[model samples]
Structure formats: C-alpha cells, structure tokens
Target: MTTTIRNGIMIAAMALALGACASKGAPTSQFDFGPLPAAAPASASSIGAIIVADVTGPAALDTERMHYRLLYSDARQSRPYAYNQWTSTPSQLLTQRIKASLAQAGVKVLSTTDAAASTTVLRMEVEDFAQNFDSATASSGVVRLRASVFRMHRLVDQKTFSRSVPAPSADAAGGARALADASDAVAADLLGWLAALPPSKE
Candidate 1:
C-alpha cells in the first residue's frame, strides 16, 4: 500500500514539472501583411489574363522565421528574431500579395496550373527581404525582387524592384510595419509597370 501511494505522488510531481516546462517558454508572435489598399477600377488598358508564379528565394528565406541583418555590425550574418515569425514563408506571403495586387488592377490572375488559359506569365525571385539595422538605434526594412514577364513562353520584359522603409522602432513590431510598407510600395510600382507594358497581341 505504501509503495502504491509513493508511486502516485511521484507521478503527480512529474506531471507538474512537465507542465511548468511546457508553459515556461516565451510566446511567439505571428504577423501577416494586413489589409491591402483599395484597387482602382479595371481599365480597358489593363492586361487581360496572367499567371503569377509562386515566388522563389534563397534557402534561408524558405522558412517561417523572421530574418534581420545588422548591417552596421556584420552585414553578412542574417539572424532570425526570437519569438517573432510570419504566418508563412516570405515567398508565399509575397506571392499572395502580388497576386492580390494584380487582380485589383483589373488583370485576371490565374493559377500556374492554368497555364494553357493564359499567355502572359509573371515570375518573381527574392533578391533581398529582411530588416536591416544600420546602428544600435536605427533600422529599416528592405525588399528587393526581380520580376520577369513572359508572353507565350517568350521572355518579354524583366526588371528588379526594391523598397526600403525606416522602421519606427528597432524591434519585431517595427520591422513588421516597415517590411509591409516596403512591400506595398514595391507592389504599387509593379502594378504601374504592368500597366505600361505593350498591349499583348493575343
């Protein structure tokens, strides 16, 4: 009887200890791009249909981790912020954002699987996507992307777009805002670029 009682007490103690350990870890914060700006009405000049391919990037950016760099200290070393992360990979987020922007501009955004349905394809690759700290108290979010436009599998145009926005603070929250701002800026510029392209013969 005594042995059974002692075993029960030990089990209870172990449960409590495990519970404490599980709850002791810091809580992680998740973020997204937030609401996008209202898109203007589609005009007759807009591209008819397009397929925005899934964005591709370096292996480092393939995860949900939030990345940052201390340019003033060691520019080559990119670090992930603790207890802060994105809802998805940087590539996925940016791809969704670009598709939304294209649809808003009156372009019919199609899926890559619908290749036969569209002649124009837009492919983007991440060149830079991280918050960069220039000093102990100053930081900015920078995003760079190479955009390629293909018509009927033929490359028509390619360009690189970039935006850097000053962070309001030197923390995850600030980085999120700055990055979103930079992303929006780049999307706007891309929208204009798409509008200016020569009218497709198809």
Candidate 2:
C-alpha cells in the first residue's frame, strides 16, 4: 500500500479508538455493603474457637453484583444493577460478618483457611439476598441463610435465619444500606442461636 494510504488508515483507527473510549465515559463507581453489626456482647461462658466455612448460594445471588426483584413486574425474575456492585460475593461478605459477630460474642473465630485450628465448623447456605421492589417508589432488602454447626465433621445443630429491612430510598445506595441492615440482623440471630447450643464436642 502507498505510505499516504497507510498513514491515513492508522490515523482513522486511532481516532475511532479514541471516540469509542470517550463515548463509553468514565467507569461507574463501585459500592459495598457496610461492615457487619458490632460484635455481640461478651458471653460469660467461653465457646471454643470455630472456623467459618465458605457460604454457598445460587449463581446469581452468589456473585458480587447487586441483585433485585421487581415485584410489580416479574416478582420471580431477578435483575442486577449495572452501575452498582459489591466488593466481594455476598457469601464472602456474609461469612466475614458472621465471623466478626461470633468473635464479638466472645467466641474464638477462625477463618476457613485455618481448618487445622478448630474441629468445629459453621457452614452457611445462603438462600436469598436481594432487594425487592414492591413499586418504583418503595423497596426493601431481604436476606435468608441457613446455618449448620459441625463438630468433628459431624452435623450437630442447624437453623435458618431471614430478615427484610426497608430501604430509605429506592435507588442502589438505599438498597445497599438496607441489605447491610438485613445482613446484620441475620448475623445477630445466628449468634444468638449458637449461644444457646452446648459447647462444641471434643
């Protein structure tokens, strides 16, 4: 090809790339659910250290994208917010909250990575985690999780906890705050349930 033609093509390609980038605009700002509730009050009896197992859930709820349901449209269909996302998967964030809650309650909390440190394990199965919109003007955050206690690889106790908190606003930020509140409520409930159980078996 002629040098003139080649230079023209290169310039055109560069301009096209620049235009595409500019049209895309700046990246969306990322947001995360707030930290879990403050630690539970200290317990008089010391619970042995326990490891938090990785929480499991469906593909949609298992991800970091903020999910929601439109009750006015398709209550069963789940949708994601393109501009909003979590810092990590919902399960991972919930696991961290649970660990913090337990530790605050005077229980020695170990992470899943520290399996050798404790025989007692707490496994959580997340059932639901999303914002439900009853109308364009109103919404609430909902979270449901089932927790199981295992001692020496054997299931000892299990229970389910669910919570829904009203969103102060109808947008993503409001939904995130409500979800955080719901998560904290669930964590508190789980801690209370664990406190009622007998000490971990050797």
Per-residue lDDT for 58 in model 1? 95
> What is candidate 2's lDDT per residue for 13-123, written digit by digit as tens?
454334323434556546666655556465625467888887888887667787777786678887766656788888878777777777777778888789888988889
Tens digit per residue, CA lDDT, model 1, 1-202 = 5999777756754543343234446798898889987865545256778888999999977899887776755799887776789999988989998888877777789989998898999999999999998865578999999999999889999999999999998777788889988988898888888888887888
The deviation in Å at residue 120 for candidate 2 is: 1.1
Instruction: Kindly report which residue pairs in candidate 1 clash with one another.
Output: none
Once superposed on the true structure, which residue ranges of model 1 sit more than 4 Å away at CA?
A: 1-24, 40-44
The segments of candidate 2 whose C-alpha lies over 4 angstroms from its true place after superposition are 1-27, 40-46
TM-score of each: 0.85, 0.81
Winning candidate number (lDDT): 1
What are the Cα lDDT values of the candidates? Answer: 0.83, 0.78
